[model samples]
Target: MAGSGETSEARALGEALAALRRDCGLSQAEAGARIGMTGQGWGLYEAGKRSSLFRPDVQRRLTGALGATPEALMLQAPGGAAVSTDRPKTSHPDNAPAHGLSARGRAFEGAASDVRRLRLETDELAPWASAGTVLEYALGRWPRRGQGCVIQLQDGLRKVRLYDRADEAEMVVLGAGALDRSERIARSDVQSVSAVISRLDDA
Candidate 1:
């Protein structure tokens, strides 16, 4: 009976974690990548098979990766009510000048932490960005349509593309060069889609 009870509680906690991750618009792979874990490892937590899920530190790490708090996790658990599902407001209008940097870009300028940088070694993104251009991206921030983004695939391939749109099952993007055709990629194969907050060209 005690074993069954523990299993039930773990499952409930896992469900709550899954709920929070969905609320943040993250896939299992994306959430796991944020914490340097594999999607399968993260799934173990959601399947209630990982004992570490019961630790406060583990709870914080999991929730933090989803941009949530431990309190939110508990509120999302079974029999708990009052979980807020509000999302953050966009800092600028969608019609903002294309030449202007985004609010996130301004904030990331010269700030070394919490941002990942990628240097283009090919002209695949020409016109928008050429070889030798450097990109700084934020992990959790989703890009607006037409904005630049870096898509990380589950198979360890990363592509720089123009964000088009995404639904529950797939995402469409505009590739560069002769491959400039609009392409649809399966969401399940994607690990993360990070917004390219800033781009710098080599002098």
Candidate 2:
């Protein structure tokens, strides 16, 4: 028999999973169908009857079915709320577009001081970003799924890849070659992961 504390934790996790499913506009049955699970089977997780919810693999399967990440599930846990990054759009004369400049060009010109820039010298991240592209990234901002990010290694090497998902021990990223080719990198080897906010083509 399970102890009270363990049971309570399972219930909390269940509630969080339920919240994430709801946020994705999915019913239990619909959400489960994505991963080939039956409605009743999936309900067991939401009802906190299945201890498998405590497993990392199970959490990935459940959340992936709802098109969410495990980190997102934690945010949906008890007393936690979904995080938002929306900001009110503001305009300034200095930020206005200059003649012959495209919208993105103007954005690059007016990027915030805190935004760090990097120049790509390879086609590793081709199609998304190519050689000679200038990338503007925010140092501490987390990247949304499919967004570009700069992953800096502890050894001072940097990799530009599309952000996938990250857990406590490792981060999965879409690597250099194909968008579907994912690579898992240990968190210990990472110094920082910065979200790429803008990409400017070389002049």
Candidate 2 per-residue lDDT, tens place, 56-158, comes to: 4466557655645455666677755332112212321334421110112112333356479999888878888888999998753456568898887877788
- Each prediction's Cα lDDT score? 0.69, 0.68
Return the top candidate by lDDT. 1
Q: Write the per-residue lDDT of candidate 1 for residues 16-94, one digit (tens) a residue.
A: 9998888878889888765556789899999988867876546655775665545567778987733322222232243
Error of 1 at 86 (Å): 18
How well does candidate 1 match the true structure in TM-score terms?
Answer: 0.48
Collision count for each candidate, in order = 0, 0
- List candidate 1 segments past 4 Å from native: 1-112, 176-180
- Per-residue error at 135 for model 1, in Å? 0.5
